[model samples]
Target: MAQHDDDRRFSLRHLLGLVSRFARMAAFGALASVAHAQDAVSTPAGPSIALFYGANPPIDELARFDVVVVEPDARFDPRAHPKTHPAWFAYVSVGEVNPHRSYFSAMPRTWLPGVNEAWASHVVDQTAPEWPAFFVDKVIAPLWKKGYRGFFLDTLDSYQLIAKTDTARAAQEAGMIRVIRAIKSRYPKARLIFNRGFEILPQVHDLAYVVAFESLYRGWDASKQAYTEVPQADRDWLLGKAATIREQYRLPVLSIDYCDPADTACGPATAARIASDGIVPYVTDGDLATVGVGPAGQP
Candidate 1:
């Protein structure tokens, strides 16, 4: 009888232990679900207003938005600028040579194929392994020292404009991916934003915090010096692609449309359209010389 009683006791204790373990696991699962729900709820509904390629606004003005993208050499004191919840990012041209910079003179002229002279920026051979080191030393480090929080890497798709063949394009894309990965590894905490590099976004998406598309809905006609709406087909294609990135990668999409600031209606209309697609939008002039706060009381 005593033997049977001992067996019953052992069995009961084992059952109790199993029930306790399962209860603990269930509690943990519930807590994890709540945490994930909170994260989703906290995600920003829209991107904060941002400025790119312009003179720095006064400290008070700059504090109005959530981010500021500007040229690396732009004269501004980031440290002295009051924290307006804005994260300042310096611009770095990834695949183009700006003649205005003395550093371009040091780079071999051979690197530039001179295919597109529209922007007065020469497209460089991204496949060249030496470019990454130069960019880190001259661009990334300097911006970091200036107290900038991150980088706005541009011209990533310039190679596609100049590439003559599929093989050449693939090589250029691979090179860009390598350089972006290197930069991410070097500065893990820095926020990196790529401009209109949708072709290579899949490969480097993990390394980037945001992707910006310039001239999305509207583009500037350099010859006419007027704003023109993009074709419906192009708009549809871009919106579809942006949706995929946002859904699959969970990265915020930022849209920049060029328009005449004097046309008051353009800014609000563009912002509403972009926000409807769940993307952040900024309407600015072609040169990006002036700042547009977007309709009054809107950020």
Candidate 2:
């Protein structure tokens, strides 16, 4: 009887030990899984390859990109819900008025004295008191409500067109600074990207998240319908300026080089040259209907 009782007690002890060991292993495994999940969430993804100035692609196709720039009234096929999607910015231009619109009905007394023949767009007088308010109310507010996370703020360089004298140029730049500051104040969390606003970059660098240069390496030849390399001197000057903005302001530089879609070499070469300067490159058609990849397979 004594022996049987001792045997029973030993078996009970062994079962308890097995249960404790299994519980500890399960707990450790769960903790390791949680740690791995957190690490995956924290790791930053690669820089986004983006498209601009075109109708929105299919939602699944659009999801593949990291950023997109579209007109205020541009339509989306499936209706992009960017707020719930992976991090991306939808940008709208702020400084130039689209020439396609009826100017008189859109805004009274806002257009600058001349039309930009090259783009068929009217430059806005940034100094006009009502200009910023009109933009915020009519453009920025509507887009923000539609779930856009950024502003492209094109035509910051348009000030260069009207500023014939040093004093006039300085005033134009100051006006740009004021408008940018106002946008920043209103939408503190929104991403602000200035397009080729090199002269005004130093003044508004703190307020901007990115600076983009269009046609840095290649541009469309309307006569030949082909891509042409920019002059070496021009390329050197722009690259130098881009480097300064990147290093000094700690801002990322984005380069948009337009190329003839049929020229396979142009896309890869331009993207490589732009990337060599430590700028994110996007090679697209003049109308930006398609996205091109770099030689290194970067988007």
Candidate 3:
């Protein structure tokens, strides 16, 4: 009887030991899985950017980009649902009013300084109080109703081109700030991508979803009416400025370099070079009329 009792006790101890070992193993496995998940959440995939102003780009291709900017009114197939794409942004020029825009007919004549001969667009007087109201109620609300969740605010500083003096530039800067604040207050959740709003970046850096600058490697020379390589000095300045902006603001920076659409090698080569600097790159033609190099490094 004593021997049997001793045997039973030993069997119970072994079973308990086995159970404790499995429990420890399971706990460790769970911890490892959590650590891997945390790492994945912290380190996101590389960013991709695309800009297509032309009509009816391939929907499947547009969907591949992490973000895309397009002309909202450019007729697209209703089935594309591009207006509802989470990152598809409508292009909005804050500092210039193009005659082709729907609101141009209603734009006040006093708001214009003169035509930006390069693009045949009228520069806006950002200092005008009416402009912000027009932008919020007339320009942006219509697009919001159409389902756009974001705006690519281009030409944010085009007023600088005609400001002509330090005082005038300061006033324009203040005006831009007011407009940005109004937009943010109206739609706090809307994603805003600013195109080279460097002058006012410090005040509104946190408001930006992304900061983009054009012509890091190649660009359109309005004077020559053709594509041209960016000067070395200009490239260096822009690269350093971009790095500073990225580090200081902790904002994602995107570089849009113009290249000949027909040149197959230009797209990938420019993208690779720009990517080397830890910046997201999108190489496209000057007109931005066709899809070009995207995140995949090729068109």
Candidate 4:
């Protein structure tokens, strides 16, 4: 009878122990849920970006964004902006040169082998050793002196349009990489934002501050000379590239979708669509002079 009593007591104690353990686990899980909810509430928002290729806009308006890309002007001073001074980036075309550029007159004729008739800018032979030096010293240094520490490097792979063969394209790609490395070496603190340098992204992703691409949903069709919907094939290709950039490299992405500046519905709707893909979206006209709708659908 004593043995029977002891066995009963052991079973009762074992059941109570299990109940206690389960209760502890349940309480721990509940606490974790509460912590996660708090974290969701308190986490800071991502960078809000704006791009304006024109000269100075209202500093108060530009200060609204976290990052702003503008055309380099000798007169524009970032320090004069509001307390929430946006990180200003100067627009620099790496794969092409415009006739209006101060250094354009000095470019060797051989370096201007191709012309982008759409924008009336000449495609540069980035492979030339002289090009990177000229660019760093002549083009970028003067802007740096003007207190512009950030650069929006555009048309990085536009040389591919004129590259005759795979080998030629690879050489151009290598040259572009050299230019990027040179920039980083020269100014380690400069924020470099690349505009669709997808070919060389893997090589320079670590050096970049942000990877920006255009035409996710809508953009100016150069061939058609109209603002049109981005074809599905092209859209899918860009979407895949963006996803890999975000998922694999863990980099922030910005996408520009061109819409009529006057089309309020299109601007907000397109911005919303691009934002849905976890990218910062700026829907503006091709000129990019007007401040348009942002990811929040705010103008």
Candidate 5:
């Protein structure tokens, strides 16, 4: 696991070559979302991290670690997490709205999903200029006001998938940028972090407080209740993005590679190798929804 820290400097250029291959995937929109790190954000001593799936983090397991990553729904109250854990993140996706969220009902039909691929999770229209602002004002601001340390932005690729026009793409990009700007402008001290931002890394990295490179290699399938193989392209893509984010963006990173809650996804050996890729890895279900009472999250 320690090898990634030692070899990252060497792999920087090699990974950028891989990024060139899948850049076309930007059809969704060429935008990235990032939350910048604040003074409060730091590498945990021995840097052990605790990751939780629900609105509330398992503080009992977290107290022993330097950091905790928890999902933040509108229902979540950041004040509920322990004060002793200096690094805390509010898990929210600026790219898409979950069908279960309170505000999903307020979305207009025009802003709904264009396709249902990649698990039928709801996708939104980032082309709308005000949409990102709504997320900032309504969701982000509320979390910040609650005294949360930072954000964990999931599904950033959704915007690129939904927007069809260059204009839509531009607006979509602006929307993500606006979300970051709004937060930094209001709370300069607050850290903003993003997850798995391969397609939009060029536009988004500068604003991030941290870069979360998810599933850099093979992981588990929660739905199938088994371990699964992450595509070589996907793995290469994440590796390249990680290299870019680290070298060009100069950002700290964490790897959330879900090996299934079942633990049968990747063997312990592979899981260890995932951590060696210059990230603080996690083993969770990668839950994307909050209000929906269901089995765990993503598989």
Candidate 6:
């Protein structure tokens, strides 16, 4: 009788211990639920951008929107101005380097495929393993520390030429992914915006939050004049790229194109096509800064 009583007591104690362990796990799962609830990005108003130091739109005007894209070298002091603007994306060209940029010195001759005389953006050698890190460390970190929200990766189309349609494409893409992931690891809150670079959509389409489609109708000439053409084939090609991003990534796109600034546009069909595409069209001379904001900075 004594032995049976002892066994019964032991069994009861073991059952209680199991119950305690189960309760602890349930509490832990509840806490994890709370942590996961906090991870979503805050929804804000529409996106806006300024060129040449936000001169086209006063900082105040630019601030009216949720996100503002700016030049990499543009002067900005987030603490100095209003605090509430949700996101500010700084522009950086990863595929190429402008000769005037500080990093141009680190560029090697081996990296230079050639130059686009029209845009004047130097084609850098993305084949270099260290090039992407240099951009993230030098350009991206500084902007994020300065309170810029994310990055506007511009002139990425230049990558198509820098890398031959062989091993270079994959290599260039891997390098860019490394660069973007590095930025996100440090500032996980910052959004990644890719401009052009449509060829690599399969790789980076899902990586970016917003994308800007370029060279729709009026591409700029060396003289900065609006060289206009419908080029239905080109328009269709770009739309196809947009379709890929939307289908693959489900990210919002901000399509940008050049048109005549004055009241006269080269063709009415051009204006209609831009509107139909459901992208933000900036109908101006190639220069975005001039017509966007007046001297007083009224929109």
The candidate scoring highest on TM-score is 4
lDDT of 6 at 30: 90
Candidate 1's C-alpha lDDT? 0.77
- Which regions of candidate 4 deviate over 4 angstroms? 1-46, 73-75, 82-84, 222-225
TM-score for candidate 6 = 0.70
- What's the lDDT of the predicted structure labeled candidate 3? 0.83
lDDT of 2 at 242: 81
Clashing pairs in 3: none
TM-score of 4: 0.83
What local distance difference test score does each model get? 0.77, 0.70, 0.83, 0.83, 0.61, 0.63
Show the lowest summed lDDT stretch of 10 residues, model 2.
Answer: 40-49
TM-score for candidate 2: 0.76
Separate clash counts for every candidate? 0, 0, 0, 0, 13, 1
lDDT of 3 by residue, 65-116 (tens): 7777888879643335745443778889999988988999998899998678
| Residues 1-299, model 2: lDDT tens digits | 99999999999999999999999999999999988876543332235556645665544554555666655555542234635343445555555666554333577654565466677766677777777766676767766777776777777777667668999888777777777877777889988878888888877888877788877889777556677778889888888988798779888778788888888877887777777666777788877777565324444
TM-score of 5: 0.69
After superposition on all C-alphas, the RMSD of every candidate to the true structure, in Å, is 9.4, 11.7, 8.7, 4.8, 16.3, 14.2
TM-score, one value per model = 0.80, 0.76, 0.81, 0.83, 0.69, 0.70
Tens digits of per-residue lDDT, candidate 5, 1-299, equal 68986588558766776676567455323443112232122221124444576644445555555555566653556566546654777778777776777677777768775654556567766666677667777777777887786777777767777777888777777766666677677777876667765556677666677777556665546566555667999888777776677677777666655544445534344445554555544555546222111111111
Candidate scoring better on TM-score of 3 and 6: 3
- TM-score for candidate 3, residues paired by index: 0.81
Question: Which residue ranges in model 2 land beyond 4 Å of their true spot?
Answer: 1-46, 77-79, 83-91, 101-104, 221-226, 294-299
Per-residue CA lDDT of candidate 1, range 238-282, in tens?
888788888898888887888788897787777666666667777
